[model samples]
Target: MRLIKTGFCSLVTAGSICGCTGPSAEKPASEKYNVLIFTVDDMRDYAGFLNGYAGKVYTPNMDRLAAQGVAFTNAHVTATVSCPSRNAFLTGLRPSTSGLYNNGQWWKAALPDIVTMPQYFKNNGYYSAGAGKVFHHTPGNNPPCSWDEFQDQVFDDPWYFQDWSPEKYWLDFGYRDPKVPMPDWKPLNGIPKIGNNDWGAIPGKEEKDYGDVQIVNFARDFLAKDHDKPFFLAMGTYRPHVPLHVPQKYFDMYPLDSIVLPVIKEDDLDDVPAEGKKLAMEGNNVFVKIKEYGKYKDALQAYLACITFADAQLGAVLDLLEKSKYADNTIVVFWSDHGWHHGTKQHWAKQTLWEECTRIPFIIKIPGAKYSDNICTRPVDMVNVFPTLVSLCGLPSMEGLDGHDMTPLLENPQAKWEYPAITEIKVGNVAVRTENWRYIHYFDGTEELYDKTTDPNDWYNLAGDEKYRDIIESHKKWIPASFAKPVPSKEKYYFDPGTYTYMDRKTGVMIDGRK
Candidate 1:
């Protein structure tokens, strides 16, 4: 199987190819390298370089970064959802190990002692600062111990942040006042507004005022100043996620007429198992509604526009870093929480174990690594991120991490790696992805097998075929024998943010999770 390099040269005909062919820019040696991580929300592999989408994506900044860094071409997330995925990667623990299978459970309330990546860095004498939706976008999730200074996310959309009562929490599902000016094109494609499901250019909203832009501005300000010690700066972009509201200019980038819908077969779910079929039907049900309205192309255009807008925010910070004092010594890690689906396999949105949901564009830029502008085809997941950073920065080895250090692959893209990337949706539901195959096993003994080499769309499930028994066995070894019991949801405990204690809502008994 040939892997395409979605570098600037391959995507655009007129771009310079010098960055792809030359060595990375030389930087002076430093005692401790600063860390700069950009986490984008609901972004799939739709970079101009990754080509995750069938339509032409305009992401010059992502392409440029790929050309200057080592792009992990076959990277997958530990979990498919935002909360579990971020928790698994940041905490260096898989959902199976942490028992955090969904968005309702707060990690701080469930497992307080777990040292997150930022907290680990802060513990190791590094100054930590962050802004925007790094965690689950909940107020209580971002504890003070993780950072010396942090900025909360602020949205330009008027519908959001209008009310903030304890009952409403940070993200209230209730509707706002009818007088407020919401996106005129909401329920875009006439589909139901299931969980902020809308996208378009919000009139009178400037690009600079967008929530993601404000987050990047904070990072840029931090970059502009010289810190007393090496800093760990993390910035998150909330575009291309939901209510895909951006400036008019980004929407203009992808005209509705030029948008190409994802290629999906009518009978894609026929061969899937009961569990797989259930997940596919959930996605297909949404797609069916989208198709009934005859607005699939319009929806794609809005999603594509959001992706480009997010890319622009990414470019802004990258540009500032290049011009800043820490350009040489800072390590840049760009990743999305999970991938989004645009009518792939007759499915819409993420949460499925399929490629569109689990696969992501992961790039790590070590200033003076032996290899740059290279592609690593080995299967790696977000779980390796924490330990890999620890190894790269020469920090002491952390005990009890589920992932292995990926330093060898960073040093050499073709290094021998035996571990396959594993992604989980809930307890006992897992997807094991490798270079040539993806095997999924569900809690009820249902299974799905796809040969990535032949069928990238996973249109065919070969799990029922006896010929692939050995292949299934090989992938099955990677699955956990037992999963940890799920922790109680936030409703079970009344959390005191000041004390970081969880009290039983019914019993009124206080329990300190940090202990």
Candidate 2:
């Protein structure tokens, strides 16, 4: 296996493989460094350099990941939904491969052979510690399985005990409006009384408290703990997700007049096939009808505020690391489970093939890696998290993994990379993204194609536009190798017949999970 190196004098001509041929080619430079993976629940590539974002949202901590490491503008997770998207990342398997398609499902039933990324870290002499939402709904239940110790920074589950503090509580407890929420609210509570306490971030000040502080507080303490050897810390943050909750301070960071919603022409859904239109209209089941630009802007602003809070929280972790003995030797990898969609084609949240939904923000900062302040637009799938780290850490690349080693791109930022990544939604919908093209295969034998080069907004679907069939054919060249695994019955991914996920581990399978 060869790795790519930046600034190398060698070049590849018309027909040659310009690969590993330097002293750095021996093994991964990050082998012995401690690992810290900072994952935001739902975020976009709006950090700093990704540039096309429409907000005043600036992530200095996220910028650190990109400036000091590699920022992947073209990275994507398999699903936009939480549970499945995360299962794919941790298991090194696609949602299709792992049989994790919806938040309504569990991974253990269909894919018990899987070992989570942290589990892999724990297997080898690392003291793994995790805080917050690492594996979606599993939340606090993540068991110190992969981690030596785990704690939920927020309330027990999705709702927190501190809900009464934020304004969102007034909405759930005050105004129960689902479709339309008030555009205005007061941030009377301001900051939490406990400086290092863990709480959840609900959209406005009322739903859930800002959870970033809670998660990062536990994470920083873990980093400062006495360690006999290297440690692996996983910090999961649920922000920029929905019911968007953040402190009034973060919300104030971006004024309403300063917000800009995506441009959607009246004919935006014209090219979309009937089925794609159906799904888009359903908005991944979370939303039914499309809200006007004004409503979405407010919604998106809340999400962005959560991101801002998340950014500052990330700084806390980085601050503790810079002060710790392991500062220079630890490797930090930051990513979001999946990208989000805020009224693009009338969709919000995850579960769409659009770039806004599938593309995740990935940043890797190895202690002494060759790349820095580099933006690799090369397409990378969520599955690659497995093989990339394994190779970089000098661990044998796992056998039968879905992703390839990304070591080369880290070095040769603009190398002739492979084709686009392939992601699956349900069994029938498949999306492929090459450098400038995005193609989707829908469930009703319908296909949606967009010439990303010409249609950045994906306003025009080119699937049936016979004139562009060649470009569509080109994207098809990299159809993922299909496996013949039988689809598990929907019953398989559901909670065990008599089990309550909230109960103690010893009481694992008995409450029917019918709450």
lDDT scores in order: 0.79, 0.64
| Residues 1-515, model 2: lDDT tens digits | 12333322131111111232223333332334578888887787666667657656668888876877777888877776777778778878886566667764545544445678877767766777888778774422253356677765464224323332234332332343443343233121232221111123334344334455677668667767778866778887767665455667777777778887777666777888776777677553332322421244555566777788778878888888889888877778888887777667767556777878777778877565555337788988888777666655544335676777676666655666875788777666778988888998776668888877888777778788898788877876665455334334433332432242332244343222222
Q: Which regions of candidate 2 deviate over 4 angstroms? A: 1-31, 139-143, 156-209, 284-294, 370-373, 480-515
Cα error, residue 323 of model 2, in Å, equals 1.7
Q: TM-score for every candidate vs. truth?
A: 0.89, 0.79
Best by TM-score: 1
TM-score, candidate 1, is 0.89
Instruction: Give the per-residue lDDT of model 1 (tens digit) for 1-515.
Output: 22133322222112111111111221222466789999989988888778787778999988888877788889999999999999988889999999999988978776767899998888877899998888877545666767888886686554554544443333323354455445555544356544466666665667777888898779778898979888898888887887787887887888888888777787887888788777766667656766787878877888888888889988999999999988877889999999987877666878899999988888987775434337889999999988777766655567788887776666567777899999999788999999999999999989999999999988889999999999999999999988999988888778786686778788887756434
Q: Per-residue error at 441 for model 1, in Å?
A: 0.5
Please give the RMSD to the true structure for each candidate, in Å: 6.8, 7.7
True-structure Cα RMSD, model 2: 7.7
